[model samples]
Target: MNSERILILIKPDGVNLGHIGEVITRIELKGYEIESLKVTHATKDQLHKHYANLVDKPFYPDIESYMTEGPIVAIIATGTKIVNVFHRMAGDTDPSKAAFGTIRGDLGREWSDGLLRNVVHSSDSVESAEKEIKIWFPEK
Candidate 1:
């Protein structure tokens, strides 16, 4: 099988809630190798660039604000079909709706009056991974 490289972002809320270590451990246990990792605050320009595709989204501003609310950890992990595998590990985007054993399922919270506040982020596909990797790790 061809190996896949994905960009994973542990959002500020997740970091503040102390889910980063557990999330990384889960990723490692899933047999993914950490190609790169860093903990830094994402500037507005960075977030704007990262979520450029979502600019047309009605929730774009909120996403941008939330992303830059605090420090975030960005990780690049590689493994066979890692992108897909990681999504499964993340469960649904909404923690309340996520299945058990999934990261979101285990560590999700309510936002905007009980809306989804799932922790962690995994690239949805290889193409997306490539695009996101560039946004966060342009040097690579």
Candidate 2:
């Protein structure tokens, strides 16, 4: 069976707020299999590499700090079109605009910090999925 895989990172806010189980539950409920999972505090280097595209942005510092503030749950979910499915389930990057049933919409809210603390991150495309899965789960 050919299965697609995506990386899901439950951000620091989500972990700090105790939403890891809920997030995993949502993914499992959608019929995707969780192939691997881990909870670890992200490093400055990892965040820099992960968000390299945004490294030059003014908000990058806040984002990097927030990501390193607490432990994050990194997950690998596999299934048919799992990347797109999980992204849809995670909702928009801005919780304020996310749909009601999505993870962000159900559990997130706008923060005054301007960090868009939207609970989770899912790979946006096949190429990104491959790259991110390697970053988070290199042994795979």
Candidate 3:
């Protein structure tokens, strides 16, 4: 089928706050195909590797803590232009100023100190999507 593929990581907070189904529903409603999915606790090593890009950022430690706090649901969705489309639906990383109707804007909370605490993560580009897919689903 020639569908562009993308990855979605429903964060710890999202899963803990009971938004997994809602988030999945929104994605499916947008017409993406669920290629592979799983819900599991993230290991410290996986967290470190998955977020290696942010390792030098100041907020890296906090992000690492939050991600490892609980279990996350990882998913691989496929569709035409799924990467770009998913990012649009996910909204800005910081949800406060995100436009309405986006997942983050609708379900996210304001950050008082520094963390965005957005509901999910979507790959930023095709290369990133491919790399991320392997990180999250190496067996695929």
Cα-based lDDT for every prediction:
0.87, 0.88, 0.86
Clashes of 1: 0
Off by over 4 Å in 2: none
Local distance difference test, candidate 1: 0.87
Model 1 off-target regions past 4 Å? 112-116
Q: Please list the residue runs of candidate 3 whose C-alpha ends up more than 4 Å from where it truly belongs after superposition.
A: 111-114
lDDT of 2 at 43: 81
**lDDT-superior candidate, 1 or 2:** 2
> C-alpha displacement of 122 in model 1, angstroms?
0.9
lDDT string, candidate 3, 1-140, tens digits: 46788889999878888999999999889888899999988777777787888888888888887787788999999998889889999998888877789988888887566666888999888888888888889998
Comparing 1 and 2 on TM-score, the stronger one: 2
True-structure lDDT of candidate 3: 0.86
1-140: candidate 2 lDDT, tens digit per residue:
57898999999899988999999899888888999999888888778778889999998998888888788999988999888788899999889999999999999998886776889999999889888887777798
Winning candidate number (TM-score): 2
Candidate 1 residue-wise lDDT at 79: 97
lDDT (0-100) at residue 119 of candidate 1? Answer: 77
